[model samples]
Target: MMIQKQYKFYAAHRNEELNDKCSNLHGHRYGVTCFFEVERTGSLTTLFADFDDSIEPHLKREYDHAMMIHVKDPLYQTLLRHMKETGETLRLKCFSCPTTVENLAHQLFTEITEMGFRLNRLEIRETDTSVVSYTREDWVNDNRYFASYQIPPSESVS
Candidate 1:
C-alpha cells in the first residue's frame, strides 16, 4: 500500500551559486508532498495522524518560517551576529550547499527517510509555478552534494 501527505512551510533562502535574482534572499510558501510505501496491517497501511505526528515537528522545528542559508554565505554570519548581539530569535537552518529548490528537496527527502519512513517520492513546490520532484533513485544516482559536509563550529558563532 501507498500513502501520501502534504506539508506547507514558509522559509527564506538564496541560491548563492546563481548570479540572478535567486541569489537575493527571499521567502516562499513551499508545499511539499511525500509519497510513502507501507505494508498493510489489516485495514490500514498507516495512520495519517501517525505521519503527521512524525513529520510535522521536524518541519516546524527546522524549516517553518526559518532562514536557510549556506554556511558560507556572508549573510549567514551577519544574521548570526545580529541575532546574538540583539538577543533575538531567528530560526536559521544552515546548509552545506546552495539553498536552491532542488537541494532543499533533497535535504527534506533525506531527513524524512532518516526518520524510518519508506519514502518513495517527494515533490516540492517552490512557488506557484515552480516545483521540484525527487525520488530515492535520483538521490542514489546523483552525486550527493554536500551530503557529508559539516559546518565548522567557528562558523556558528551564535
Candidate 2:
C-alpha cells in the first residue's frame, strides 16, 4: 500500500552565485509532497498518517519563514556563525550543495529517509508550474550502500 502527504511552507533563499537572477534574496510559498509506502497491514485504520500529528509540526518548525542556507557557501557560514553568536532564533538550512529546487528535493528526500520511513518520492514546487522531484531510486543506487550487499561467489571465483 502507498500513502502520500502534502505540506506547504514559506521560505527564503538565494543562489549563492547565480549572477543573472535568483542571487538576491527572495521568498517562495513552497509546496512539498511526501510519498510513503507502507506494508500491507490488515486493519481499517487509515494508511496515511495524520498531517497535523505526524508532519505539520515538523514543517512549521523547520521550514516556515526560515532562511534556507547553502552550507557550502562561505557567506552563509559567516552569517550563521554571527547569528548564533547573537542568539538569533534563525531557522537555517546548511546544505552541502547549492540551494536550488533540485537540491532542496534531494535534501528533503534524505531527511525523510533518515527518519526510517520508506520514502517513495519528494516533490518541491518552486513555482505553480515548476517543480523538482527526487525519488528513492536516486539514492538506492548510490555507493554509500555498497557495503550492505554481498557479492555472490560465482562472480568472485572468476
Best by lDDT: 1
Candidate 2 local accuracy as lDDT? 0.70
What's the TM-score of each model vs. the native? 0.88, 0.77
lDDT of 2 by residue, 28-137 (tens): 99999887877765764244554346567767766788778676567776776777799775667555556788767766676667667777888888899998777888
**C-alpha lDDT of candidate 1 relative to the true structure:** 0.82
Off-target runs (Cα >4 Å) in candidate 2 are: 45-47, 50-52, 81-87, 141-158
- Candidate whose TM-score is highest: 1
lDDT of 1 by residue, 1-158 (tens): 77989999999889887889989889999999999999987976788988899899988888888888888888888887888799997888887767888878778887888899999999999889998899888766543434345433211121
Show model 1 residue runs off by greater than 4 Å. Answer: 142-158
Q: Which pairs of residues collide in candidate 2?
A: none
